[model samples]
Target: MKRFFIGLTIVIILGLFVGTGYFLYQKSEEPPIIYETDTPFKTDIIKKTIATGSIVPRKEVALKSQVSGVVEKLYLEEGAQVKIGDLVAKIKIIPNVVALNNAQAQLQTAKINFDNSEKELKRQKELFDEKVISEFDYNQFLLDFNLRKQEVEAAENNLELIKEGSSQKTGNVSNLVRSTVNGMILDIPVKEGTFIIESNTFNEGTSIASVADMSEMIFEGKVDESEVGKINVGMDLSLSVGAIEGVIFNAKLEFISPKGESDEGAIKFDIKAAVDLKEEYFLRAGYSATADIILQKASDVLAIKESNLIFEGDDIFVEVRTGEQQFERRQVKTGLSDGINIQIAEGLTEEEVIKKL
Candidate 1:
């Protein structure tokens, strides 16, 4: 019985050894790598740069006060359409004490002088009728009376202007602020009873409201200094507004800044483009937008996936599949890339299959 048990144990050990050897042999073998393939095809590749900015009216005017006063009434509100010479707001003049007093005093003095001149003219006319005075002397007295009468009228008009910001002789009132251009009212910055300064040589004055020609819109954006050299006037741009979804507006470049400005340690140049507005959509001023400025474009050209390209120092190459699971490296000349598909300017054909990296 002991001999039979020992022989069984030896056979069991031999079976375990064979199983371990087979597992080791299987682990040492690796699966063959199968490469995926792609073929060059005709496609449109556009290389572009992006600019971020806002949509604004090409002509925007700030309505300012012509005379200093307190706002009494506003004739228009935000988003209201207005025409040229339309009343926007009315101001109540707060007359200066010194100026008002001076005007009143001048008017009083002129009236007294006029009363004396009238009496003297009447006396001179009676003497001339009696032949007691020469015609030339009577004419001189008449001219003096006319001059004094004109002075009185002038003084009255000055007093009226000082108190009311207008006079009877001038039909228009200075305190009535009017729109200088035809546009839509964008903002009303002041409220009732708000004091405002007049626009003059010394000060810019307070803006009562802002009006802009909404029909004529423009895109005002800034591009990086590195990309500005590639763009020029008359180029086309596609605008995507943040507020408006699924709509793209077309624009033509009009102006590019000759100088660059620094912002956050990087230089940028300002660019303006005329937007072709659509009648169906009303674009308000100051709408945030982004523009896609095409730097270069290739249409109906042979292109391959950018991932298939391999770079070695100054040369670019791709692997061409000559046989099943076989590929050989071939140098290629590439042009405009939209960051996904690249244009194969030379060294590749649509009929040849290239290995996908």
Candidate 2:
């Protein structure tokens, strides 16, 4: 019985050593790696750069008051359609005290001069009728009297303009703000009783309203300096508005700034594109949008996923599958890349399999 127990213990020890050896051996041996493979396919690859901006009216006009005054009435509101010469707002003239006083004094002086001239002319005419004065001397007095009368009329008109912003002879009120262009009212910046300054040589003045031609719209955006060099006038752009979903508008590049401006520590160039507005969609001013500017494109060409490419110093290569589980490095020339798929310009074929890196 002692020998039997000893034999059983020996068998158990030998079994334990065998199990440990097998586990260590399995851990040391790694599974073979199988690389994924792909083939070049025909696709349209477009190389583009993105720009963030908004849609705005190409021709925007700020309707400003011609005379300084308080806004008495608003004839139009935001989004109202207007034509040229349409009354936008009525301003009540707030006449300057000093200017009013001067105008009044001038009118009084002109009236006194006219009255004196009238008496002299009457006397001269009576003498001429009696043949006491020559015709030429009487004519001089008559001319002076007419000139004085003209001065009085001028002074009266001036006083009326200061007091009421209009006169009978002119028939036009300067205090009436009118739309100079035919378009929609984008905004009415002033309300009733709001005092505004007149647009003049000294000041740009306050804008009473802003009007714009909604039919003609432009995409105003900025692009990074690195991408601006690749773009030019007449290039096509695809605009995607943030507010509108699943709609893309087409536009053409029209203007590119010759100089760059700094924005948030990055140099950016301003770009303007004329939008081809659709009849169904009414694009409001200042609709935030993104533009995809196409720099280059390849249609129905052999393309490979950009991730499969391997880059080295001044050269690019791809892993071409020579046989089963076998790949060899081959240099390839690339064309347009849309940041996902790249055009295989050379050294690649649609039938050839390539390892995906």
Candidate 3:
């Protein structure tokens, strides 16, 4: 009975070991990699380079103040539509104390001169009427009186302008800052009560607002310097905005920077393209966008997936499926490739099945 139990235990242990070994062997064996095959099809091949950029107005102008003063009033807000010569803001001129004093002194001097001229003119009139003075001398006195009166008027206007940034002579244009272009207001950086400087020869002045022609927008992006040489002005660009999905904006290449900029230790060139926005679509400025610039395109050509092509030293080839799971190496001349489908210029037919590498 003991021998029988021992023999049964040995048989069970041997059977378990054999089964475990067989399972391990099967798990270690990898399944065959079934290479997929694709047929050459008639398709358009567009060789393009991608550039990351933003949608901005072609003409974005920063509205700056012409006079230094506190922002007394802002006529427009962000996102407001504006036209050329529209009043954008009112700057309360904080006149210089010295300038104000000088203007006041000049005004008083002109007034005194006018009063003396008036007395002289009256005396000259009396002398002329009495025939005691020559006609030429009386006329000279009359001219001096008229000139002094004019000087007094000019002095008053100048004093008003220096003190209040406006004068009676100038209409609503005084202290008023107007838009220089027809566009939408993008931003009003300065609020009412904010002190701002005027744009002058010494300083660029404080920017009150930024306006842009939203109707005429452009894609401004940078591309790798290596790809810049292939692109030129007037190339077609397909732009995709991140914020505005489901719509592709069409644009034409307009300007490419003659110089390159350094980013992340790589040289990149700036590029600008005019965006053709649809009537139903309203694109806000500074929207992040990506553009695929078409460098070259081939129409209705026999093409295959670029992954199907194999490269050798100075040559490109593809394996054509001649039989079941059998492929024959054939040299192929390739043309345009948009990084996906490659145009087969020669050595392949539309009906031929090629093995994917």
lDDT of each: 0.94, 0.95, 0.90
Question: If scored against the real structure, what TM-score would every candidate get?
Answer: 0.93, 0.92, 0.83
Off by over 4 Å in 1: none
Off by over 4 Å in 2: 311-316, 322-324
Please state every model's RMSD to the true fold in angstroms: 1.9, 2.1, 4.1
lDDT per residue, candidate 1, 185-272, as tens digits? 9999999999999999999999999999999999999999999999999999999999999999999999999999998999999999
Indicate the residue-level lDDT of 235 in model 2: 97
**lDDT by residue for model 3 over 174-207, one digit each (tens)?**
5788898988999888889999988989999999
**Which ten contiguous residues of candidate 3 have the minimum total lDDT?**
165-174
Q: How many residue pairs clash in all the candidates, one count each? A: 0, 0, 0
Model 3 TM-score on a 0 to 1 scale: 0.83
